[model samples]
Target: MKHINLLLLLIVTTITIVLLWQGAQTREKESQLLEVISRHSKASDPSKSSDLTRNSAPGGAARPSAAAFEPDHFLTELNSLLDSAGTDSRTVQRAMRMFLFDNKGKLASASPKALKEACNKIEADWATDAKSFVWLELVSEIVKSDPAWAIRNIDRFLMTIAKEQPMEKMLHYLGKNGRLGDPAWSPEYAAELEKWFDTAEADGRLKGMDEEAAGMRFDLNISLGNLLGAVEQLTHLPEDSLSTRLEDLAASSSAPSGQRGLVEAVAAAVPATDFQDFTRALSQHAGFDSARELLARAELTAERHDLAAAGIAAADIGPQTAARADWLITTLRDKDAGAVTGFAAAWTQAAHKDTAAWLTSLPAGDARDAAVAGFAPAIARLDGATAAKWGLTLENPSLRTSVMDHVYREWHQQEPEAAAEYFGR
Candidate 1:
């Protein structure tokens, strides 16, 4: 029993000694870490060292010694702390926070070189497992002081850990609607940004930023007065939101120095392919009367004339859409009644089934009859027998006879016997 008790006592003594040694090591490590942080804090503000020295002089208040701001020395100690084994995340985060941010999480006025070096070191060592919020915040702050440098370096930070917050911040800083007190946006700057967006999109950093990119492009084109380009961007946006943006354009365009009357002018100037987008948006955004007024006031070349008529025809034909169509047919009948034929051709070329459905939905009367009259000619161009049969379905007897007679005359010119036989039947 005596031997067993002694053996137990020995075991306890060994364990106690080991624990004391470990406690002492922990305290020593903690002390070293605190000293490093103290030095870093002092370096962030060089005035602290001067204040200490001044206070230590004659007739000065007594003060503690402060280490001078030494980028090289401080970095060495910082790297050493990070290199030590068993360093926890809390320790690393606290250390980096002290090095990069003040009490309010704002960046300190550290030299750019030191800031960059320290950030690079932290990102290299500590960012292997997770993205660093502290690092991203630092970049956001940097964007204010040197946007160009931030813009150039941001992609590097995002290579492995792409983040949307910082990317958007960088873009917003350069966009025209930037925060108040920013430098006025210049067209040259916009042009440069256009190139950057193009490359960033190609590289995939701009993935999922379609709406934002479109908005920026719209603003850039506005600054450059590329009306067609600006209007083109609107097509990518939500249909419901187009009215407000169009209103913005109209408000500005009403000014004497604004692009007033140019909307109509550009309609005739640009190619049909380009002007189609403008007319589509215009027809959908404005009510029927508004669309009619705008189109009526404009001087459209032949290329766009039919497209404009088609845009109205394809738009939502409520009372408003119906009114616009009637007004176009009645008002322009003497001058360009052939526009309706073109409208029918364009609509049918894309979706004949939809054209048939639209014609069916029209109220029974002159409107439906006139629309059918327009469609008959275009359909005859496709299949004259089919068009003559379609004209026979019309309710107005005289109108039906007239339309069928016209189809008969055209068909006779192509297939005389077939036309006579079909009409006779």
Candidate 2:
């Protein structure tokens, strides 16, 4: 009987402990749920409006209120309400802020020391209660007003930011406000910022950054190339490296021909004085135009005494692309009327796509248009329908319109009645 009683007592104790533990967990969960509900309920509660404003002011401080800010109260006994809600930090913060705004007289009465203490508490608790950006704003205001506390704790508090999404918001706030460049800029901080920037740039996800938040803080605060140190840490690239890591990627020959433009553009923008040699050495596939551009830069100008290299550059232009951007100028001044029509045919085919891109990419002026227009007769043969559609997407709208009108005239000479249907009513 004694053994059985002892065993029963042990079992009862264990059951009681388990019940208590579960009850405690239930209470904790309930409390957390209530906290969330309280946040939303307070936000929507019309009565909290005045409270929110007063506390949001720069120096709004909490004070002894004339009456308890309404919160749920539980009755302890007759004529006694247990003050379940009075003086909670969040409640106090909102009410004090609202009261301060509603009556500056109340704010004026707050002692400076008290105000500072209240601000510190509210700011310290912000990361737990407010949005992450809210904490940034709170810290920023705190740092601006109370650099003493910030200088001491900013590092510790900032770790909370890394866990948040859209970390750029926090980074931008710090970077733009000059905090990123502060004496606190450690090697670890710089390395992380560079990693984030390179990742964002690589993924093409850098668009969310506002113009003011464009560059990393180090980029703004340090010398232009100083951020190179962090990038160097990544891959220990060459001393004169200018190309991004992506420049190394090559497309397989089986890829679509349309992808050629993107590949060529990336390769051209890459930093390589000897790109023609490097690319040819790397793969069976390479863009001849890009190769020619590299070699052309090595050509000597008459001014530079490298004129020997100019002919070399011209030769490298690969018969396909160099199809004569050269003398066609004086040629199209084609003083020969019969040769004019023939020249037009060749020019139209070469200049079909990105014609305006080519024209504008050159030195600007009416001169270029006049020269390119000499090929207009060629363009006419290329597209009668496109010529008719000119009013829509023409470059140099006025000049193109006139050119179209002239082409119409020429077409009229060839077949006047047929041309009327194109250019005329």
Candidate 3:
């Protein structure tokens, strides 16, 4: 009778423990919709939130599963709303804005004819009010539903234009639905664009309307990067001769400087034997110009058995190497060739010498910061042989806590036993 009571008590305790654990899990798994859907049918950007917790200083707010925010629900609601509408353009425009906010090809089964009719309906009835927008949604639909139509209608729907016209936004979409769809630009359109550029150069938005001009220039700056990226894809510039066009782009005064900077960064990705040449080319940006490129170079150098060169290159990359660490530990591994001491020392110096300065130089933005924070954990996850080699080769005691914590916290939940072994728990 006493034994039965003991078993019963144990069973009750186990059930209580399991129930508590499940409750905590459920709490952690908040419904993403109830949390942030200003309404049931639109994707309110988390960026709009005034709450500091939503945009925490570091490590980011814990994300609920991204998949939980289903576009299908919004699309279903949109279709039902559209079906009941009474030929109202404002109503149609509102529906389109909702559709665009959750743009993920939800109604992908609709045919090309249906898409054309949809585009026509939106174009004819799109609202002139600042209170709502449907053009971006319509443009996104045309782009995905039919790239050919996107190409054909490129002139009709560009979001930005140098000058305001009664229907320029619609025409902009028709021209570059996907990149100057009509390869042969009408001479008249070319002349118009040229005239716009001349106005930008002469009266110059700087003197005429500085604020609006600056905004327009900012938009133009972004467009040029995509334009050049598209051009590169279409041309498929050979690996060896990649820099020629890039050089041309940088030297062209009309080439947007921001776009040129991006082009310079991408060109640095081309694999090559001469580290010196690649480093020299990318250093022009003044924005820790060599961080990502040098990180890549360090990997290549370690692979080539040029340990001294790799170390020097890593040092040149400075502290930002720790943040630009897309693959620092992997870069150091260099196959199963075991560890190279020089590469390890170089990396330690680059990361530890000026920790704050190095963090400062890395890419800006929340995602970049999180990766920077994880740099140590990344190094901790190195294979056993490499980790041991790394331990013996370096002497930075300050770094151990971060590296160990990164590994233990990361691996513990997923593989607790292995994580215990990793942290020597």
TM-score of 3: 0.26
Q: For residue 38, give model 3's deviation from the true position in Å.
A: 15
TM-score of each: 0.38, 0.26, 0.26
Better of 1 and 3 by TM-score: 1
**lDDT per residue, candidate 2, 98-160, as tens digits?**
332333333344444443454445454443332232233334434543444543344445445
Q: List ranges where model 3 is wrong by over 4 Å.
A: 1-96, 99-106, 126-132, 158-425
Model 1 regions more than 4 Å off? 1-149, 152-219, 222-274, 309-316, 331-370, 373-388, 391-425
Clash numbers, per candidate = 0, 9, 21
Summing lDDT over every window of 10 consecutive residues in candidate 3, give the lowest-scoring window.
29-38
Top candidate by TM-score: 1
Q: What C-alpha lDDT, on a 0 to 100 scale, does residue 383 get in candidate 1?
A: 77
lDDT of 3 at 301: 37
Pairs with backbone N, CA or C atoms under 3 Å apart (clashes), candidate 1: none
| Candidate 2 overall lDDT versus native | 0.40
True-vs-predicted CA distance for residue 375, candidate 2, Å: 12
Model 3, position 291: C-alpha lDDT score: 40
Q: For candidate 3, write residues 1-425 as lDDT tens digits.
A: 99999999999999999999988755543232223223333233443344423332234463322233233343344445455443556544544443343433333444556556555654555444321243344444545544545543543343232235413343343333323322333333333433454454584332544333333332233344333432333133344553543333333323333443443344344443332233333343322333434433432434443332233234445545554333433344444322223333335434543433444454543322333343333344443323333333223344444445555665565666776775578
Candidate with better lDDT, 1 vs 2? 1
